[model samples]
Target chain A: MTAPVDDPATDERLLSAFLSGDTQAFEVLVLRYRSPLYNLLLRSVRDPQTASDLLQEVFLRVIKRADKFHGSAKFSTWIFTIARNLTIDHARRMQHRRHRSLDVPLGAKEGDAPSANGTLVDRVVGTDVVGERAVDSQEIQRRVAAAVELLPTEQREVFLMRQLQGLAFQDIADVVGVPVNTVKSRMRYALERLQAALADFEDHLEGTR
Target chain B: MSTCEQHQDNLLEFILDELPSAERRALSDHLSECEVCPAVAQRLRRGLALAATLPIEEPPASDTKAIMRAARERSGDASTSVTASTSMLPFAMTGRWGRVRAFLVRPQVVMATVMLLAVAFGAWYVPRRAELGQPPAATMTQPLVVASSGVSAPEEAPAGPDGGEDSAAGGAAQPAPAPPDTAARLERGLQAYGRSDYVAAIDELNAVVSAPDADEVAWTSAMHHLARSYQQNGDCASATRRYEQLFRRSPSYNRSNQAMLEAGTCYRTLGNEARARELLEVAAQDPATREAAQTELQLLGEPPRARRPARQPASRSGAPTAPTPSQRPRHSDAPY
Candidate 1:
C-alpha cells in the first residue's frame, strides 16, 4: 500500500524506496509534486511545452540521482532545487538566444522595458481568461498571474514557492541558497509588488470576495 | 530593532501561519494598534488572496507515464514485461525483408556492419595504394564518424587545445565532409545545456568540436558551449582550457572577450591568479566585457585599470563592487 503522499516523511521514504528498486515509489513521488512543480515551471517559462519537458527532466534527474539524497534535507527541498536550477538555466538560454538573434541589436540591455509587442503574459492571457465576459474569479486570476510574471525573477520565484508550493521560508532559503531573512524579504517585496500592480483590481477583488 | 520593524519581520510568518503562537499573538496585538502595520498586513493578505486565484494545473497524464517508464527503465526493470518481445516476433518473422529490416533497426548490428565494411574497404584500399606507390589517403587520420549522438564514442582522436589544430595540422589534405548531423548534435548539446544537464552538453558539444570537417562557425560555437558546459559542471580546469582555446583560435569571434573573461574567472577559481589576471586584463580592454572583467579583477584584488564613471554612486560603506551573480553579465552578448 502507498503511504500518504502529502507527508514530507513519506516523501523521504518514497525516495528511499525508489533508490532501493521500487519504481512505484518514484511514481508516487512524481504524482505528488507534479502539479506544484509544473505550475512553477509554467509560470516561470510561460510555456506549457517547456514546462512539461522540464517536469519530465526533473523526475528523470531524481531517478538518476536517487542515491545522492542523504535524507538530511527534505525531499521536496532537493527536488525543487533541481527544478529551480533548470528553470534558471532555461531563462539564461532564452536570454542568450534572444541576444543572438540577428534582429536584436547587440547593445540592447537586459531587462529593457518590454517591447511594444508586449510581454509574454500579455501575449498568453487569452480572451477566455481576461475577456469582459469572464467571471470575476477568472479575471482576478489572470491579473494576478500577469502581475506575478512581471515581477523580477527573484521575487517571482520566492512568491511562487511560498504562495503556490507552500514551501516554508527556511525550505525556500535552502532551495534558493539564500538566508531565511533574504527569502522573507523577497517574499515581502513580491507581495508588495503584486499589491501595487493589482491595485486597480481592488473592485474586482472585493466583488469576488 | 524598532517595535514596528520587529513586527514587520513576523508579518509574513503570521499570515502564512508559520510564526510561533507567541510571536503571532504579539504581531497581531501590534497590528491592531499600529496604523501603518495594519495596512501593510492587509495589503499582503490581499496579495495572497489574489495570488491564490491562479489555478493549480495538472500536468499531462502522458508526461507522468513517461516519467514512470523512464524511472523503471533506469532502474533496470524495463524488461519485466514480455509483451514487447512477443509483439516483435511476428514482424521479425514476416519475410526475408522483414528479418533484414529488423536486423538493420538494431543499432548495434548496424554499427557493427558499418565498422566491418569500413575495415574491409580500408584493408583492400590501403594495400592497393601502397602497391601503386601513392601517398596514403587522408582518411587515415580522420576520426571514425559515429552516426549516433557520440556520447559513448571512443575518444581516440581527442580535440586539440584550440579545437582546430588537428585540422590545421592536416596541412594540404582536403578537409573531410562533416557528418550530416553536426548541426543536430550541436542543437542537442545546447538543449542539454538549457536543461542543466551539463555532462550531456559536454558530450554532444565535444563531439561537434572534434568533428574533422566542422565548419569554422560550428566549430567555434561548439567550443564555446563545450567550455560553458564544463564550467557549469564544476570542471573549472577543463572549462578554462576550452575557453582559452576559443579565445586564441578566434580572437575575432564576436564573444571572444566574454570567453576571455570567463576563462579568467575560471582561472581564479582554479587558483591560478597570474593567468587569471593576464586574461582578464585583455578582456577589460573590450567595452562589452570591461565592467564584468573589472569586477572579477577587483575580486582578485587587482585594481581597476580605469574607472569609468560608476553606473550608480558607490555605496557609502564601499561594499564589494562585484555584481551579484544575477546582475553579472551572462551571455547577454553571445553570438549563439
Candidate 2:
C-alpha cells in the first residue's frame, strides 16, 4: 500500500518514510516545522539571518542522522533538542568572543559587565512610562518585544518556548535539560519580569477595558 | 504559607490555561473574591497577549528547497536501491534517442570510455619510451611516502627553500630541523589529539608550534593540531585565531580548503555570521570541500550555489579521490 504523500499522520511516520527512501516525506516534515522552529530560533538568536541559518542546520542534522532517532521520544522533542544544543553552542562561542574582546573574565554574566548606564533590565524597564500619554497597542507590543530581548537568556527561552511555541512544560524541560519544576519556575520568573516591565502598559490596557 | 502566597503558585498556571479543569475552577473562584488575585491574573494575561504579538516569521522559500535537495542527495548516497530505481525510471520512460543519451551520460559508460582512450594512448607511447632508452615514468618520480600514524615521516617532510637538506648546512637563519625533544613533543601532541585528550594535546602541540628549531612542516602540523585541540576543548576564541593564522601563513597548504571551512564554522559558532559566510563562500569553490562548505553556507542563510548539471566521474576527471587507507585522516587530524 502506498503511503499518502499529502498528509502524514505523525512526524514519526514522515521520518520513517524518509528513512525508507521517501524524500517527499522529509519535505512534508520540513514544511510542517518551518515556521515554529524558525520563530523559536529567531527569538533565541535575535537575528533573522542567523535564525534562518539555524533552521536549515536543524533540518540538515535531521537529514544526516535520521536513522539514529529512536522512537523512545517524540520527533519534535528530538529536533528541538538539536536546536537547543546548537543555540547553546552559538551562545557559548559568542560569549567567548565577547569576553576576549572586552577583557571580561570568563564565566562573568552578561548582566554583570560594568556599564555606565545600568544593567539591561534597568535601562529598558526602569523608565517611567505610566505618567505619559496613553500608548496604542502597537507601542505596547514594541515595548514588550524590547523587554523580552532584555530578559536573561534562560528566562527568555522558557518564556518563548511556552508562550510562543506552545510546548508543554515537560517538553520544554526536556529541551532545556532541566527538571520540569525548574522549567516552571523559569517561566514564572519570566512572566514576573515581563509584568514589571510592562506595568504601565498593563495599566493603560486595563483603563481601556 | 499565607493564603495569597499559596494562590500565587496556581495563578500563572491558571492564566496559561494549563491548570487541570478542577484546579482551574478553584483558582477562578478564588480570583473573584481575593483582593490582589484578579489584578495579578489580568497583568499576566496582558503580558502573555503582548508577548504573543511578536511576529511569527516564515523562513525564505529557498531554505526549504535547499534542505529538501540536501536530503535527497544524502538519501541517494546512502541507499543504492533507491538510486537504482529512481535513476532507471527516467531512462526507461524516455524515447529511443533519450535512452541513448542517458546511456552515454551514465557514469559507468563514461568511465569505460576514458579507460579505453587511456589504453590506446599508452599503446602509442610505450614503444617510443623504449626506443628513447628512458627510465620508466614511475621510477622517474620520487616515491610517495605515506605517514605512519599522525606523525609526519621524515621522507614526507616538504623540501626546504634551499632544497630538502637541513637549513644549518646552508648557514641560513631559517627554521632548522626539529630538535629531538620538539619532534617527540609533536608526536605526543598528535597522539593526544588522536586519543581525544584535548587538554594534553593543547599543551604538547603548543610547544611544538612555538619551538624555534621546528622545521616548517612540523610547525605547520603542530599549529593545526593546536587549533583543533582548542576547538575540542571548547576554547573557540583561541581556535579561530589559530585557524586564521594557518590561512595567512600557509595559503597553499593542501588542506587549506578544509581549514577554511572549519574556521568559517568557528566564526559562525562565535556569532560572526558575516565572516563565516565569507570563508564558507571561498571554500565552496573547491571541489574537495564544495559539499561541506555549501552546507555551512546554506546554514548561514546563503543560498545554495547552482549545482553543475552533469555529474562528472571524479576518477576520470582526475579530481581528488577519497583518502587512501594509509592516508586516513581522522576528523580531527592535523592539516599536515
Candidate 3:
C-alpha cells in the first residue's frame, strides 16, 4: 500500500520546493505516476506512438499550469484532468486526420469465437501460460481491449482508472468530474460487461479446467 | 440467487483493491454467508488483474525527456533572470520599483496626483496672517470650528464680532443647548449604522467620543463604532490606522480585542496581507483573540488547524527552519 506522507503536511510544500529550485520533487512525482497515466493515454488514443507524444503534451501542460494548482483539488486529480484534456485533444487531431469514428472496435474478426472474447482472467492466465498458451493470450488481450474500447468515453475513463489502474472511486470521480457514486456505478457496469464476455471461461474454470 | 447487480456492487472496491482492511474483513465475513458476492468478487478481481496487465507501453523516452527538459529550462531561465535582477539591485528594490511604476500608469494616478496638488495648494492658501505690505483676501472667514461651549445666552454673545463670518452666527443665534440625552443620540447613531449610513453614524459617534462628559464606556464604544463605520465605508487604511490608535490609547478598553480583530480584517481586506497575517498571528497566539483568529485562518485555508509553537533552538543553528505557514504569514492566494 502507498504510505501516506510520513512528513509534516506543509501547504504547497511540494510545489514551493520545486519553485525554489529543487527539480527532483518534480521527477519523483513523474516517476511515481508515469506508468498508470501513460496507460490511460495509450488506451484513449489507441496508438502507442501517439500516446507517447500526447503523454509529453500532458506533462508539458502540467508544468505550464503548475502555478494554477492551488491545492483546491488533489494534485493527482488535477494531473489526470490535464491528461484527460490532452487525450481529448489527441483524439480530435486523429479525427481530423480521417479517423472516421472515434470508437472503432479492435481485433474483431469473423471467426473469433464468441466464448473466446478475452477478459481479465485470460490475461492473467495467459501471462504464465507460455508458447503453447501464446495464442490464447493474444486473443484475450484483443477481446478485452475491444470490449474496453467499445465503452462509452466517460464510462471507459472511469473503468480504466478504477478497475485497471486501481484509482479510488473518489479519485476517479475527481478526475472525470463526476460524483463518486457515478464512478462506482460506471465501474459496476464495466465489470458486469467484462464478466459476461468471459462467462464461458468462468464455467470452464468451474467445470473441466 | 442474489442479483448480480447487488453482488458486483458490493465487490466494487475489492475489485479495485481500495477496500480498507476493516471493510475487506467485513466483506470476507459476508462472502461466507452469501455465495453470490464472493463469486462476483472473484470474477471481478480476476478480470481487474488481467486488465492491470494490459500493456501500458511507456510513453517514448524522448517525449518524457523533452517535456521535463523544457520545464527545467523554462524554470531555470525565469529563476536566473529573477536572481540576476535581485542581486544587481539589492533587496529586490527593482521589483518594488517595477510595481510602483505599474501602479502609477493607471488612470487613478491622475486623480491622486490632483488631490496631492490640491493639498499642496491648501497649505499656502490657508495662511495664518498676511504680510505687512500685503492685503489679506477681501473677505476672510474666521478659523472654523474653534471651541464652542454649551448653548450660551444671547446676552453673552459678542455683537458684530471681528472679521469672522462664524463670529456673527454665534452672536445672532444663541446656540441651541447640547442635546440632553446622550444615550438617545447614541441610539440614533446606531440606527444610522444599521441603515448603512456610515458617514452619519461616524459623525454621531465622533460627537459621542469627544463629548466633554463622555465616560470610559461611551468613549471606547464610540471609538470602536466609528472605526467600524469607516471600515464598512471601504476606507480600510483609515480604519486600520484608527484601530491601531485605539489599541494604543485604550489597550484596557473592554472592546480592545474587537478593535484588534477589526484592524487585522481591515489590513486583510485592503490587500496589506502581510500586515493582516502578522496581526492574525498575534491574535492566534493570544487566548482572547484565538477563536476569531482560528475562523479567519481556516477561511484562508491554513490547514492542519493550529500548530504548537516550536521550541526555540538551543544554539540558533540547524537546517534552515521550515517556516510554519502561520509564522511566515504568506497570503500567496491574496490578490494584489
Candidate 4:
C-alpha cells in the first residue's frame, strides 16, 4: 500500500516529532503501520477482531511512553517484538484455558464454538461463489494459512517475519529474542514442515497459471 | 559433515536471495548436482511462495481512529503519568528495546498530530481568509490599543506608533494618529474603551460596524475591538456572542482563540458552566491558546455531568431484577 506520509521521514524522526509534541507525526506512524500490524496479528490470532485489538494494544503502549524510543533496534523490529509477545501471551492464556486436544485441527477457535477448520476452506471455495480458478486459488490460500497456523509457535513466528513481514533473519532474531542461528534454524524448520504438510496441494499453485 | 550437510543450513538464506555471492555460487553448484539438496531447495521455494499467497487482511478501518480517540482522552492530562499502568508490556524488557514500549502506546502522538492538523488548517485558512477580506493598503494597518493600563498590547493595536503617552496611569501604552472614516471611528472607540468609557466606545463601534461602506479588514478589526469593548464594558453576554461569531466565521482572526477562551471565562463567571466548558475545551486544543484555556478551566472547577438514566435489568420472567454494580477499585497486572 502507498504510505500517506510525505517528506519520507524515518520512523525514528517521526517518533522524535511525536515526543517533542508533533501529534500528526504519530498519526502518520499509525496509518503507516496499521495494516501490516493488523495482518501480523490477525495472521496469528486467527480472528480479525482479536487481531485488531492486539494491534490497538501495541500502539496504545507506544502512545503511552511516546517520549522515549529505543535507539538501538529499528522501529519495525521493536514494534513486531511487542506484537509477538502479546500474541504469544494471548495464545498461551487461551491454550491453558482450553486444554483442547492437538487433534482439534489447525484454524480451530480455542473454544466450544464450532470449528473454523472447515469454515476457512469452505468460505474460500463455497459452492456458487466464483469461477473454478478463483475457487482453486482461494483453496490454496486457505490451505496455506492452515499450514502456517500449524507450525510450531517459534517456527511459525520466524516464518511470519521472513515471508509475511519481510524481515531479515538477523532482524527476526532480534524481534524473537533468539540468536541469529536459532532464527535461521526455525525458518528452515518452518519451511520444511509447511512443505511436508501441503505437499499434496502443490500442483494447485495459483501463481504459475 | 557431508557436502549436502554443510550447504543444508545455507538453503533458507539462498532461497531468500540473501546468500553472499561466493556462498550462492557454491550452493548453486551443489544444488545443480546433489539430488537431495535440489529437491529440498525446490520445496523451500514452493513453501515460501505458498506462504506468500496467504491474504493480507485489511483490518477494520475504525480501529486506528478508535485507538487515536482513546489516546487523546487518556493523554489529555499531560501531568498524568502515561506508564502508570503498563503491566501489559510484554517480555522481560531487561535490555534491548526496553525503553521503546512506552512511546509505542502514548496518546501524545495523536494529540500532537491533531494540533499539527489544526495549525496546518489554520495556516491554510488564514491566507485564504486574508485574500477574501482584502481592503485598501491604507486601511490595513489601522490599530486599536487594548485598555491595558499602560501595558502595551501590540496585538490589539495594529496602528503605527502615532503620538502621546497614554494619559491614564492604567491605560494601554499605544499611540496612533487621529484619523477619520472607519479607521478614525475604530480609533475613537478604542480610545474610549482604553479610557474605560464603555458607553461611548460601544456606541462608536456600533456605528462603525453598521456602516455600509466599511472595509473588510476594518469590519473584522471593528468587531474584534467591539467584543473587547463589550468585555471591558462588563457586557459579557454581547462579548461572548461577538467572540463566538468570530470564532465560527474567522477562527484566524487575531486573538480569536483568545476570544473563545475569554468568552468561556466570561460564561463561566456568569454561571454558565456548560458554555464555558465547551469553549475552553476547544481553546485548550490549540497550542497557542492552551495555557489560557486550561487555566480558565482549572479556575472553573469540575464541569457538571448529566445524570445517567437508571438502567433496568432484563429478566426473562416478568419480575424486576436489580442489576449488580461492578463498581470497585480494580487491581491487575495488565494494562487495559
Give the number of the best model, judged by TM-score. Answer: 1
- The first chain of model 3 has a TM-score of 0.71
- Can you list each candidate's DockQ? 0.24, 0.14, 0.10, 0.12
Each model's lDDT: 0.63, 0.61, 0.52, 0.59
Kindly list the per-residue Cα lDDT of model 2 for residues A142-179, writing each as its tens digit: 56765766554566677877765577899887776557
Residue lDDT tens for model 4, B21-131: 999999999888876777677777877767777766777767766666545544555654343234222221425464665555468976887889999998987787678
TM-score of 2: 0.47
Query: Which segments of candidate 2 are over 4 A away from where they belong?
Result: A1-8, A99-138, A203-209, B79-336
lDDT by residue for model 1 over B46-83, one digit each (tens)? 87777777767778887777677667766665453222
Return the lDDT, model 4, position B189.
68
Angstrom error of the Cα, residue A205, model 4: value is 1.5
For DockQ, candidate 1 versus 3, the one ahead is 1
Number of backbone collisions per candidate: 0, 0, 0, 23
Off by over 4 Å in 3: A1-13, A92-97, A100-139, A163-165, A199-209, B1-8, B14-30, B33-38, B79-336
Interface RMSD of 4: 17.2
Clashing pairs in 3: none
User: Residue B47 of model 4: what lDDT?
Assistant: 74
lDDT (10s digit) by residue, model 3, range B279-319:
76767676755665655544344332122111110000111
Ranked by TM-score, top first:
1, 4, 2, 3
Candidate 2: the clashing residue pairs are none
Decide which is better by TM-score, 2 or 4. 4
